[model samples]
Target: MPVVLSLNIASKTIPVDYTRTGVTGIDKRPVDGPLEVRPPGKKGSSGSGVAGDTIGDLTAHGGDYQAVYGYAREDLDYWQGELGLDLRNGQFGENLTTQGIDHTHARIGEQWRVGTATLEVSAARIPCRTFAEFLGQRGWVKRFTQVARPGAYFRVLEAGRFAPGDEITVLRRPDHDVTVELFFRALTTEAELLPRLLEAGDSVPPQVIELVHKRSVIELDS
Candidate 1:
């Protein structure tokens, strides 16, 4: 059964080498107490769905569509062995460090009932300069993209309170086979797969749909 192994929140901002803002809340730590989860408004105006969690980069980080970030403990363990580092919960800045959930294969729009909150898979976390800098690892972006287990970003469908160790129940899954890994590949390494993302319909980000349309037009012209 899938469960929230750790609920992480950034206690405070810390200085970072990347991003226009000199500070980042990427150093999330597991927190004990229940947290209110809801949509964080729109991008550039909101940060984090968890009430007390911090989002240092508002321009690209937070919104209703990206209310929460979930990374699997299984994937973390894989990286731990490869990197030879003690990768702790929240090390990757994921708000929910989950166990027994195959995030890579979770379909877009799959809904999970965690505690009282309902979360729907919305997008995949793309590696950025901040992520690379936080890890202090060279070529981290390319390396992470190559692995393509970018984790899943979820949108809060029903606001509610939840805490660590809560069991995650799959409420529903979209009928498409466009899994998180496939979506990440389409957006990154596999441009040829972009057209297939359409099968996911509105479950994926609107910008992606628009991009696919634009690509189609360009391809027809050429």
Candidate 2:
């Protein structure tokens, strides 16, 4: 059976914006309607989806931890209360809060359908210094990542809109054998992780695949 879940706009929220590059949409709230989606790419991107050539051009723009795509308003807690976490609600910052869905286990290249919108998991939760700053400590954000296993970021594969309490359901699963959580672990410290991801690069995110390729070359030469 599919993972039935729900997520509220946790205390954290981010937005998709054409202005400001820092972290688009923290103060920008999500509109109440169909959660929009679009093809992934710079062309279809509008805040959250791809770059350009998309639908309404409105979507959750930025959040480092998890991206709610496949389902909504069913699964929560494990990330919020004692079961979930206190990270995004107070740390990394996001646009919408999810009540359900384990951001960490949701693999890359996974396909999810929210209403008419479909999105593909594109990458893992990348821990950056900015996130650390948000949480107000050194390396604090990164540590929270492991503990929270923030959800995955997604690129819109189809166009649609989502609002609070919209019944969400998964239309498909991941396309690869390598899961996002596994990739995160491998990339974080597992020596074999990169190699495994490299060998399985066919299903990894494009940017990640390229990064591994470049690192592999350097490691080989060194």
Candidate 3:
């Protein structure tokens, strides 16, 4: 059973060179909590869904569709071996550091009931200069993209509170093969896979839908 291994929130923003905002909330620290969560409106206007968490980049980071970020502990372990760094929970800027969840393979729109809250897998986290700078890794973005282990971002469907060690129950899963890994690949590296994203229907991110439509138009014109 999947469980929240660590519940994290940024106590404050850290000044950074990579973002337009000149700061980042990527330095999240684990908290002992019954953290409150809810839909955080839209990008540029809203902040993190998790109460007390901060989103320094208002234009790009937090929104209804990306209210909470979840990264699997297994993946962190994999990176620890690859990078020889002491990667800990919340090290990847995830609101929830989860155990026993295959976040990379999780289907978009899959619903999970954690504590009293329900969250739907909405999209995959896109690597950016901020993350690369945070990790102090050269070619971090490209390497992350190549691995396609981009963790899952979720939207709060039912508002409630959750804490570390709370069990995550799969309430439902959309009947689609467009897993988070595939979605990231389609958007980043494999333009050819864009058509497959349609299988996820409305669960697909609006930006990705736009890309798919553009690809169709370009193909037709050619």
Most accurate candidate by lDDT: 3
Instruction: Please state the error at residue 180 of candidate 1 in Å.
Output: 0.2
Which candidate do you rate higher for TM-score, 2 or 3?
3
TM-score for candidate 3: 0.96
- In the range 46-80, model 3's lDDT, one tens digit per residue, is 99999999999888888888999999999999999
Model 2 misplaced stretches (Cα beyond 4 Å) = 1-24, 27-31, 43-47, 50-92, 198-203
Sort by lDDT, best first. Answer: 3, 1, 2
What is the clash tally of candidate 1?
0
Write candidate 2's Cα lDDT for 1-222 as tens digits.
233222223222334333234332232223344344444333223233412211222332332112332222232334345334444331233333455555567766666655556666655655655445444466665565566464566666566665555544666665556666777777675646676675444445555677777888899899
List pairs with backbone clashes in candidate 3. Answer: none
Worst 10 residues of 3 by lDDT: 200-209
Lowest summed lDDT window (length 10), candidate 2 = 50-59
Give the least accurate 10-residue stretch of model 1, judged by summed lDDT. Answer: 200-209
- Residue 82 shift from truth in candidate 2, angstroms: 7.0
TM-score of 1: 0.96
lDDT of predicted model 3: 0.92
